[model samples]
Target chain A: MQKDSFRVRAADLLDIPADIKGGLLHIEITGKREVFIENHKGILELSENEVTLNAGKETVRVLGQRLRVLAMNNNEIRLSGIIESVGFVREGSSCSQL
Target chain B: MQSAVNFVRGSVLLEVKSSYPERFFNLCARHGIEFWDMTNDGLGVFRIRMTVKNFKRIRPVARKAMCRVHIVKRCGLPFFLNRFRKRAALISGCAVFCIIAWIFTSFVWVIDIDGYAELDTARLLNELSKQGLRVGTYAPSVEMENLKNNILIDMPELSYISVNINGSHAHVTARKRTLPPEILPSELPCDIISDKDGIIHDITVKSGTPEVVRGETVTRGQILASGYVTGRAGTTITTHADAEIRARVWRKKSARMPKKYSEKVYTGREKDLYTILLFDNRIKLYINSGISYTKCDKIIKRTDLRLFGRYRLPISLERATCREYEISKASVSDETAYDSLSKGLMSSLELPEDAEVINADFITSSDEVFAYATLTAESIEPIGTKREILRNG
Candidate 1:
């Protein structure tokens, strides 16, 4: 047995987050086209930075220059970083200005 | 991974300066508070991780006058999180070790027979096999005590037995039991008899009646004289003699010298070399080549497995080899045949010193594998001494 050398990266108990349930998690970027994902699973697929999620009976697309979904669930979703705003792109609906 | 609590699991006493320390101590004891340093040292503090469930009860005790209730930063969540992984890891590690230990202990790969004497080794092994301590047996399944008892019972001459297992080796030690001495106990009075018939040289009587006289030629078992003395002219005669006569007897031995035996025999000259093996390859098996000459009977063989535990199963190797042999024996010459005849006669003939070789008449001679001949010698030797027993009414 050797000593563990993994440095503890402390975070505020409240700041640490979780989504205990299964769902699609995405990080999107408007200007950046390339995204890297080390691991993915389920009915999930991705290309570029945009993420299309059909979960909880909702087709949601969060468009931004850079975005990340830290965790997600059927009832609640956790997001991080600043966002410009949120809008939906439906089959019949188009992107509208706020 | 080990628990932090265990290293610090021993007690560190705590003494309190708070008013009514006795009450607090009692209350703590009542509430089963299991922490702290005991000696009083200016409002002693105890750091402990109490569950949220029990935290409420302690709140009232700490909230009393001159008491301040504060929950120090507890590191419980991560401790348990790490614990679940660590204990599982430890148990699984131990499980794997136990399996390997069991596997090594299960088989009796090497069997050792620790004791035996002039008893036949092969026969002992065959007997041991009947008792189930053979070479290729599994140790765990062997009932050693039962096996030992069975062996002792079956072979009464084996006094003690011990069976021990070390790793894959099963060792059996035994002691041979010796039988008691034999005695011929029946008392039947058969007349004393001489082993050989000879001319009477001397005689003495001890008991019973003597049946032969001095200067008489006595056949085998003929008593030479009487131990019972007859009283003459009012003299009382004793029925015993102090000593027996000594005699010298002639003994002879004769054997025909063989030119050669009909059966073929192996020559003492032999050679053998072995191959070395490691794993499956022959690295260096033997340190030296034994001998070079092979006679009529030759044997050549190689076996890698049985003697080496890892390479081969428990069976030895044997192989017959080809040999170059002489086609025929040269016919013995007359002079050579006579010399061989004398050599053979001298070796085989045994006679008393007084005995003489009146003549060595060679009957016949033949030379094939060897010259064969026979000899006849005559000799003189002394014989006949008797100790006779006499019966008195």
Candidate 2:
């Protein structure tokens, strides 16, 4: 209830409050893949069949895809297997173009 | 909770009272502690639990509220051990007294065998001696549990054996094993007959053969029974209706207060105690401390016994009793007299509901200070019919 220090991270699904001041983000690897990070910032959500990300704008979705968000500072996301791919997008990536 | 149990634990509990419960709760919250049993007894007596740990912290608060902060007067072994001023002389005196008392108590001064039915005194004592429970034996050395077990083992006949020590004596009470006294040793050739005037409910022949079957009509003494009837075989006899019956019987007793039976009441106080040596009245262990008030009556019983049957010494047991005082002359109307009579009758005769009180007699003259009544009750019991058969028959 107190706005004092709270953090939440999730795998397989990302249900973030869209109106949280800094907005929300999610990244994925195409092989049900693995994402390694040197450092990270926001959250990276991983799941089978799809990769979705929210970076202050629209959600990025890539199905039959493997992807990784690079240098996101202190936070990490990973998914590994099938099609084995990776990617990152800024504000306004289309969910319909997966 | 009672803290005055005189237990070995050093912990003392207090039942403190405080009006401002909120303040009390805040105090406990401020300090890492809690108060249980939060109850308000009228104005001031608020019952709350407190440990010895926080007594110092709350003492000032208790004083401020004039709260009766009772650390529930702990008479614990530690408190008693710590309470009194440390004096070497007193301690030594107590030690010496304890040693003397220890010695005194160590020696079994009196012994009584209670609850004896068939067990002989000599047999019990002999059995008790085997269990290290004889008179003049060291009380401190006597392991009561071990002694009980040992006695039980030695006399397997005793149902229960308890050894209790009060003051300087050991009370050895045991229940003697009782079975139906040697049952008429093998039933003689006897007969089954109606015990009551009513039709027999059922008949069972344990040893003898039966003659009366179920649903057989029979009268009292008109034996639907037989012992010497001719059987199917020429010389053989029919089922003998004989019974050397065993029955449980009890007797009811009735006694009227025939002549103002005496009643006793303890005045709650009695004196005249002297240190008597080994139950010997003549051999006083200590001189009687001078005091007044000797209108009381006391009953003293003495028993002498030896240690391991080596040397015997009598144990003096004095049951001091206050003398029963006689009533003074009272103004009485007819109603009060009748009430007194009824009370007296109720006390004397405890009758059953079916029992009819056929008579209530007042047997007192004008000169008599007390009045009494006699009650006659009617009851029923089966009278046994024993025919002393002539040997010729």
lDDT tens per residue, model 1, A27-71: 343333322221122112111233343333334544443344333
Model 1: per-residue Cα lDDT over B268-387, one tens digit each: 344444444332344444565343444355666756355255533333444434443443433445666677666777666665455444445555555454445566544334333334
- Model 2 misplaced regions, further than 4 Å: A1-98, B1-123, B126-133, B137-175, B181-189, B193-271, B276-295, B299-393
Q: Which parts of model 1 have CA positions greater than 4 angstroms off? A: A1-98, B1-106, B110-117, B140-182, B186-190, B195-296, B300-322, B331-393
On a 0 to 1 TM-score scale, where does candidate 1 land against the true structure? 0.36
Each model's iRMS: 24.5, 24.0
Task: Label model 1 with its docking quality class.
Answer: incorrect
For candidate 2, give the lDDT of residue B45. Answer: 45
RMSD for each model, in Å, please?
25.2, 21.1
